[model samples]
Target: MSNLEIRDLHVTVETEAGTKEILKGVDLTINSGETHAIMGPNGSGKSTLAYSIAGHPKYTITQGSVTLDGEDILGLTVDERARAGLFLAMQYPVEVPGVSVSNFLRTAKTAIDGQAPKLRTWARDVNTAMERVDMDPEMANRSLNEGFSGGEKKRHEIVQLELLNPKFAILDETDSGLDIDALRIVSDGVNRYSAQGDRGVLLITHYTRILRYIKPDHVHVFVAGRVAEQGGAELAERLEAEGYDRYVKAARAGV
Candidate 1:
């Protein structure tokens, strides 16, 4: 039973106007096989938490600790963190001009596993994962995310998620910019990954539409850079019906 634990995590970033704090003492624990949904308004530090956990250098951790299975992850580099079984699906996946999708995926898998996968089996796995995400087979030859549509990029992220099979995954706004069909496909891919019964997922989003397909084991309402309320799936339904107005008001009042 692996666990990702965040204890009083406070993160900040340097901007043109000095440093600005984002996460304000967040504490959460996600054990293997649990899916946690973080819903919040804009600028509420949702992505910051994801990036921080992924070891992005831009975000500075001023206080608190992040641990994976009792091992301190805050001190690990981004690649080291990935090797430790942490994955982050960015909202905007960047383009790699020269790296073919096939090469990139295989290379990442080899690095993580500390061994090169058998050529024939790795090719078969890559093709199977692409088909699972409804991605074109030709995409394997194209440079990663270069000239790809938003929906395609998102699908490609899921492709990586399926093939790499990380211990924990943090998806930041995965449902954004996806059409109905694309959303369903992406959600299905996520569902398949979570079905493994030993992977933890942190799904961050503003809308509850995705929740309809990917039911969260726990829903946390993020407000003012902190979790204001947390409950079961019913909390997500209420947020869908009532919106974040009440949470926003309460956050503003410092309640």
Candidate 2:
């Protein structure tokens, strides 16, 4: 079984003012078939952790180790990390002006798999993935994320997730900007992907609504860049009712 482990991860970024530490220290392990939800207030370093794991150059890992199946991932480049079965669905997917969605997906798949998928099967697979996310067939011809709605961008991310079939998926606020129907469709797509029984998912979000559809095996409450509390699904329900006020207060008071 595959495992993704983060040990005492500390990260920082260079802002206009100066360098600022984001992640203080974080330790978590996700085994295959497990879904872990990280719920936190804004600026709690949730997205920083996701970007760090995905090898974003802007976030400097001052200390800690991230490993996938016992292999050190910190040393790998972004593309290399992708090849190692790590995927990140950004909150704001950027637009690639000239790259058609179809070409981008196929190229990414080829790079990760070290081979070009057979043309016919690949085309069929692409169409199937798009349909699963409720995307129009015509979207395949559009430049990636260019002139797309926020919901469309999020849906496209899921399409990539389904096609790439990564071992671990880090979805940073994937539920953002999705309407009720779109949320259900996107959640369904995520559920289908997670049902494979051999993949791990790190779902980071601010609200508990998505949890109603995509049940997490463990729910971690992130406070001040660290996990202050963790429990089963019941914890999420409590957070939904009580909110993060208690945790935020405790963190501010140096708890």
Candidate 3:
């Protein structure tokens, strides 16, 4: 099975003041067939870890290494990381005004696979994936996420996940703006993809709601950019009951 490993990852970004470290020293490992959930409060660096692994330009890896199957990916470009079997579902999917959803998916799939898929089969696969996510087939001809609702944008992200079938998927708060029905549909799509038993998922979120539909094997509490606690499904239940207050207090007290 493949493995996505992060080692003492420290990420920073430039602001008006100066370089500020978002990830202090984070370490986590997600193997194929496993789903790990990162739960934390706001400004705790959950999304920073996701973007860092995806090789986003805005975040700089000041120290630490991220590797896929023992190959360091810090040196790879954003597209190179994707080609290496990494995918990131942004917390806020941006609008691509001119790029039609169908064309965008096809182009991304072609880029990751290193060849253009046969048109007839590609079209069918796209439709099938979109259907799985309850996305309107007609919307495929529209600009990517340009006029879509929050739920639609999130569903479109899942469509990409289904079509691209990356080795690892880093979902950054995919459950944020989705309603109950939409949440279940999106969760089902994720489950279908992970059921292949050869893919890894690192889902970052602020709440445990999504965990009900997408159960993670491991639950980690991120506090002040570091993993404060690790446990099983029970941990999520505890978080739901107790909240992150204790974790936040502990971090503040330097516990």
Q: In terms of lDDT, which candidate is stronger, 1 or 3?
A: 1
TM-score of each: 0.99, 0.99, 0.99
**lDDT of model 2 at position 46:** 94
Once fitted onto the true fold, the runs of candidate 1 whose alpha carbons sit more than 4 angstroms away are none
lDDT, candidate 2, at 104: 98
lDDT of 3 at 254: 90
lDDT of 2 by residue, 102-147 (tens): 9999999999999999999999999999898889978999999999
RMSD of each: 0.7, 0.7, 0.7
Q: Give a tens-digit lDDT track for model 3, residues 162-246.
A: 9999999999999999999999999998999899999999999999999999999999999999999999999999999999999
- Report the C-alpha lDDT of model 1 over 1-255, residue by residue, as the tens digit: 999999999999999999999899999999999999999999999999999999999999999999999999999999999999999999999999999999999899998999999998888988999999899888999999999999999999999999899999999999999999999999999999999999999999999999999999999999888998999999999998999999899988988
Model 2: runs farther than 4 Å from truth? none
Which 10 successive residues of model 3 have the least lDDT summed? Answer: 127-136
Off by over 4 Å in 3: none
